[model samples]
Target: MKVHLLIQRTFAGLNTEYTSNPAIAQLDNKLFLTDERSVVMQITENPVFSFAKNEKWTCYSFIKRALDREKRAGFYAVRLFISSAHKLTNVKDCLLTIAQRYEFFIQNNTPSQEYTDLLTQINEKAIIEKERYTFDIESIRKGTYYAIATAENLEALFADERNEFVEKLYLFTTNIDSKLLAEFHLHSIDPLSVVKWQINDEKKALDKLWLENTAIPVFAKKLLSLQGAKLYFQLKGQQEKRELTGTNELKTTALIIDDADKCITSLKINNTAVKPQPYFELYALATDTLYYTLKNGKEIPLPITAKLSTRKLIVENSENALAKLWVNGEELPIPTGKKFEIYALTTDKIEYTIVGQAGKKTTVNSDIKTLSIHLPNRGQTINDNKKSPVIDILLYALLSLLVGGIIGYFYRSNTSEEDISAIEQKIQEKEAKYEQVKKELNSSQILPNNTATKTVTSTTTNTIKSNNTTTKTTNVATKTTNTNSKTTK
Candidate 1:
């Protein structure tokens, strides 16, 4: 048997053209049509209709178009036309069964439930939109199942199931055409897999690599070298000290002398199998004062100024014996007992010598000097020529006189200037006071002279008034007398 299918892509509210055979011309303008071969058919006006065979068309045309146009495409409406040489019951059953089975297949294979429900609802909606076309099963190949899907709704119908269908066909089918399978090119390789493979390769390379332990050996060698040198110097010093001391027990005293003046600032004595008295008494010649403890617990002061010269012992005081001087098993002769001073220019190499009694009496009392004598030629000399005592005294006296004269001159000049300024200030003040007194005296003379003039004028006016009053009284008496005489007549 053979089945013929027609798929179409049409816009909404538009008619689509499809044909199975020339005898199917009755499908025009018809909502649904059934043939004598028990074929049931339906025509749907829904533009979203899609079938599994034509799934790619829906994705390319309708779904993409809808997305571009920003509109929602409805469920796929497939114009299913089922025909068979069997009875209508068998044909309907077979068609419905296929439809139901395809719905289940799509739902299982698809990525989303919404698309499966849409396809199932499209199948159920076929009865109402009855513009149907029918076909006989004999018209298609025998035992072949055919499906038609319109391109407009292809994406909506098979957007999720396309890849799954391709995979199934690839896995199950034999003698499948490569071109046909390639049409549904849907499988995509994951990009992260490639990156992960590269990272794994790099990690393998890093695991096989090695690094040298350079720092540890270098540091250890440096430390070992330093330790060896330190041990060498310590051993050398011990050897020198052992050679310097014989089998006899000797007390050792160390003194640190300053390089500038060769002054001894600190001293330490180490006595083993030797008495402290011998050590103290032996080293007393180093300084002017030697301090010792008496049996009464009193500290006694001894003055000693003697030093060892080249193979000879010299004492500052002639009473001190120099013939018995022997130091470190070396015998020394007695000199004229004149004190000789030694000096070192630089601090790098210090000179040290030992002095003791010449004869081995096994217990000879001796004195040693730990002197820090200053070197005359070590530092720069301002005056080299030695002057007589009288000339030095005269020079000191002249310098003092010169300094005193300069100081006295400065002091007298400063005092005289201050006194002159004070005297001038006093004279100016006294002259100002004299000028003010003269002005006051001239003003007093003018006021008294004007008052005396005013007094004389007042006295003259009083005398004239008295004389006029007397004259008036006399004239009035004469008039009265004349009147009385007239009255009598």
Candidate 2:
């Protein structure tokens, strides 16, 4: 984090011209104040509040009130300093009595909860006095920098403050440009109550602050850049244990250990955690099987009753290409020029190998220990496994036919010729009945009365023609007889 300090000037009755300091810059997690006298003060990872000259008094007063409020809330004010003209001096002790007397003024003020305990410790070990240290023109000119230090407990400063108490003092001599003065400064002076110790312990103190105050969730996503094997914290007893695995994304899994010491778990892809479930679930996209090994045995078998609900393998092609699918180590033959959807429900890992006629190829393998639902080429998705009712019915019918065929095969092997003939006759009878029903069904469109009428009309026309032909024959016979009679007469 980088912070910029801007200094400006303002006078009571004159136009205030200000010069900005560009040479001095704060970087990283540290603050530095330097002067022409070669005196420098450094604070590591300190939170500094800056203000314009016009706002200096208000800001200083706000900080004072904030400190006093924290003191009353139970935090101990440790060391206060006003730094300027090549020196740092303690001024907190001078205001301690005033703080104690006016401590009630900050009774309702809001200070961070962390400072409360320190202030209480400070007030407990202090005496109240009526005189208050006041900041005036002379004091402001002498002190160009101010700082406050606080601690939750007093014992922290016993070692360092005892030896360096005198060295912390500062002196002012010559008049310097107002621009050189810090825009705002205040310090809480009490060795036992400074909060510096907590800040010094960066890992313990700042880590919590970072987790709570910073965008750590976003940073956690960026942590995926540190790919390959990584360790994550998991609860084991009252302590956290590092669980290591190879991953390309941030995923959580439930750690399960079998009696044979084999580990089984699940993983999430793209950092998408399983929702509405207490434990994380991983899905294989291209496979429809679960992988598991028998305890103390190397052989893995697909249970006969194992079924998958959310697994499918799909292939799509527009040309003559064979797509090969492999479950575990078995490769499936896929014909070209057709799309296919295959579902395999087994208790083992399924590996899908896809090859194209045009040299395009891909392989996807999923561990059965983790539930994964994936698709290849965004082509097709396999959802939860559901048994179709029609398929179930067909399976039952086929099983019945197979059983009957087996029984009939054995029965016929021992049967006599008469019995065989009788069976053949019965089959023929059934075939005839079936044929009759089929014919009736095929001629269902023709009415019975219409068929009968057509038949009767054809019969009547044939009979009439026959009768005319007979009459003609008889007439010819008579004509021949008359001709013979006339000739004779």
Candidate 3:
């Protein structure tokens, strides 16, 4: 379904300057304008039509029209352009190859009637878009791919090389009715519509298909084919519908999503309401995974099962929008009572902030998950209770010491001269009193006092030589006078 070509074309010279039409003078001048600002030679078609046909030119419109003509061979021819990655190089031989592939596909497109029936009855929820409906037969480790497309896309499907079509047998297996098929065939649709296609090992699903009650020959043949001829007798032995235990009564069991991250509120199995159960008995079948919503307003997927076979089960959320309330770790049901619940925060300090949202009032805690705060309500953080009272006493003592130091510093720095003089006088008087006490203590001391002591002394001198001299002179004068009186008187 692929086209590979080695195309070769020969180029020839022209006679005219640019265009075939003379009226388009501007275009001719523009096309022929050169880097030197002068009009270059324009290309003219060969005089003979055959000469022109053989010649190749640098003209886009001409090439496009010729290619368009080539593509009109069929939708397959045009489809080559839709999937233009291949250039879809459809020469004479490439066109024949595409036709052959189309023939093979039409011949092999048939599927079993059961498959067609299954498509006709498939649920809309199960039908996938994007050209193909994928059926996962997980047990058989196989998948079936079906598509609805135009004849062009169908041919392109082959060229697409959808994986290697090995011995596994690449074919379309459909389960839609003839009416839809007719519609698909009659019109080349933009949005193609097709039915479901079941994959290989599809026989396992027949257990839920009501095969036991069907008496049709085709159903019987299908059963034989699925069981295999070697085990036909063994399968026949187990075919009889025997009620082993009619005494086992049906019980209601809650469903849960086995392993899911998302919370589901409205869940439906075939379409009745169901809840989640932590544990279930042996008589349960897990058919669907559903979601459960908590009071914290979180949705999670939980696996679901019924104690008895349910024809239809559905779960829908019926709670109000203001139902997001949780205490401890558990989520509570929606609160519509007269009184609201209280919360005890473990933090020492809490702040309340307000934000304006359009015209509505928004608080800081409005978006808080663990704790909820109502407007006009104050919050406080929890303080540590383990600190000793001795710390307070130590702090008070340090404060007193600091105050005393500050007062002493100010007394020294801001003292007046009068105050300094009075202090100096008082210091002098105290020093005199200390000296007097020191002398008294020296006189009364038992140990020898080595202090220095001072003592006072006086001396007198007399002159008696003058009186003796005067007496001697008077005696001599008297003796002389007596001698002279004896001589002269």
Winner of 1 and 2 under lDDT = 2
Question: Which candidate model has the greater TM-score, 1 or 2?
Answer: 2
lDDT of each structure? 0.28, 0.30, 0.27
lDDT of 2 at 89: 17
Compose the digit string of candidate 2's lDDT tens values, residues 1-489: 011112211112111111122432221111222121122212212222221121111111101212222232112211221112111112233234334433443454434213333334433443223111111121122223423334432123222222121212222222223443342332223222211110122112111111112222211322211112223332212122233234323232222212212222231222322222222222321111234333222323222121222234454444323444565567656544355544442333554433432344344433222222223332222223323346534533453454345435534463444444554454445446544644663364222223433443354345435544555676689899999999999
TM-score of every model?
0.12, 0.19, 0.19
10 residues in a row with least lDDT, candidate 1? 190-199
Off by over 4 Å in 1: 2-26, 33-86, 90-93, 96-489
lDDT tens digits, residue span 31-144, model 1: 222110111111122222222221111111111111112243322222343332211112223233434443564458654322234334433542222112121112211111
lDDT tens per residue, model 3, 1-489: 221111111112111212213332222322221111111001111110000000111111111011112332111110111111222211223334433443354358533211222222221222222232221122111222223324344345332322111101111222234464353332212232222222222122122222223222212222211111111111111233221122211121343233121222343333323453333222112343444343234544445433221111111112211324333344445446433332312211223222221233222232232233222112111112123445534543453454344434433553444543444444345445545644664454411232311100000001112323444676688889899888885
Model 2 bad stretches (over 4 Å): 1-5, 8-33, 39-219, 223-232, 235-240, 243-291, 295-431, 434-489
- Which has the higher lDDT value, candidate number 2 or candidate number 3? 2
In model 3, what is the error at residue 271, expressed in angstroms? 8.9
| Model 2, C-alpha of 475: deviation from truth (Å) | 44
Question: Distance from true position, residue 204, model 3, in Å?
Answer: 26
* Best first by lDDT, ranked: 2, 1, 3
